[model samples]
Target: MIKFLSALIFSLLIPLSASAAEYSDGNGYTTIKTPVRTSDPNKIEVTEIFWYGCPHCYSLEPLVQAWKKDLPSDVDFKYLPAVFGRGWLAHAKAFYVADLLGMEDKIRADLFNAIHVERRNLNSEDALARFFADYGVNEDDFRKQYDSFAVNSRLSQADAKIRAYGARGVPGIIVNGKYLVSAESANGNENIFKVVDFLIEQERQK
Candidate 1:
């Protein structure tokens, strides 16, 4: 009887030892990592895959911004616009155009607001040109880059990256090229960042 009890206790403690890291959330949406820590040999890259037309992505933007502001110096954070389908591809083009024109900071959030908040249909180059003109971007220059091979190629690459990430939906995050942190995770979006921080610390320890 004593031996059996000791074996049972050991089995229970084994699982607990593997999941020793803890995270806090005032609400119920918080998750921790599993035992097998996933790591990448390259720099710690944190990429957020989102689409401008996604309301959830829009809602998460502020939280993402906060995270970016407080991100550690060692972390490399990037925003990769996702082209999940025909509807999302246009926004992806706009994102690349902004990137090529060196106007991503000025226009990325506005594009999101235009789609989700303002209910504007910027689904075509003509519409996008009008939108850019309103924002003081020269219409011709915007059109040139919008139709440029560079922008188109980058958009293609973005689409490929989105597919490679196996993103079932928008507003998903990929950490260090391996661990995927999605809202589907037990902790949800808020906990995703916590998991990321934990992973970064784990890497530092190594």
Candidate 2:
């Protein structure tokens, strides 16, 4: 009888799933040491830092898109392209260019498809020009906006924020500039938003 009771208690103590796992600092997520500045002062901000070439980011993007639609009014969400080096810069530039032209929504998915699905080489100015042109942004227009002061500034700021957060991987999610949720921390991509939502509520209570 005691052996059966001990077994039952142990099973009950275990979390049902990764989603049901208790989220805490250094477990499901971590507190950003530097606590980077958020876009809004009055609202909770969730930033997903991603690299287009990342397979994990590709997997997580769909989940992110779906989860963001029903966010609370006080929550603000944005995507910050990760810039690890010159190799990652082109895609980051592509993100800001589409963002500057207000075409981010249109090209966001297709661009990811072109790379991950179609295996296209879109890491250069010429290739990006052609891709954007298909989406109605001409080469000259794409280049002009790609190198615009605003886009350049955003790129620089993104690099700084990721460094401040001490994120060593792509597809990183920063909540209210305080907590960071990654695949490893969340146990998998599927549970990232669960951890993110948990942090958002924690921030809300504060």
Candidate 3:
């Protein structure tokens, strides 16, 4: 009786362990990380490679923001606007322009909303200039930097990184440049963060 009572108490006190299971459909589809990490172990970098026009990415912004806000002090988070096709280049340029202007954090969320909710077409130089003007950016200055060698180079690098990460779609998370977590693993934006936390813990031990 005492052994039985002790076993029951132990089971009640100990939480169930989580299994490392691969969640996927049968169509050669599986969740993968975004922004494939380069060999930079000085920091645990987490990057989300996304496009302004991607509905999945748009839906993920708030969840990613919350995860970033609560991130461990050692973790670094970055947003890389993915330019996977010709249609995405203009938005990528606009993202680089905002980065050059030091307005990335200030305008990133609005950019997402402008494309996803406001139904604004930011996929062109002219439209981007107009959008910036609304936000008080000098059109000439923005135009100068938008097509600058530096911005173009950065956009190219971002493209390469996205491809290297093997991301077939948006709303993906790459942890420490090795593990990827995406909505494909689970059905919700919050699940991505949960996978991120899991990956971080896994990396922490190594």
* Candidate 1 segments exceeding 4 Å error: 1-42
Off by over 4 Å in 2: 1-21
RMSD of each: 6.6, 4.1, 3.6
Model 3: per-residue lDDT, tens digit, 1-206?
99999999888766533244433322112334443545567668888878888898888888887777787877888888887677888888888899888898888889888988899878888889988998899899889999999999998888787777777677777777666667865556767776677666666777
Q: Write the per-residue lDDT of candidate 2 for residues 1-206, one digit (tens) a residue.
A: 99999999878767565445578889989998888788788999999989989989999989998998898999999998998766689999999998888889888899899999999999898899999999777799889988889989998888888889898888899999998899999999998998888888878878
- For model 3, the superposed segments whose C-alpha errors exceed 4 Å read 1-15, 19-40
TM-score, one value per model: 0.78, 0.88, 0.84
TM-score comparison, 1 vs 2, better candidate: 2
Candidate 2 lDDT (Cα, whole model)?
0.89
lDDT by candidate, in order shown: 0.74, 0.89, 0.76
Worst 10 residues of 2 by lDDT: 13-22
Q: Which 10 consecutive positions of candidate 1 have the poorest summed lDDT?
A: 28-37
Deviation of model 3 at 111, angstroms: 1.5
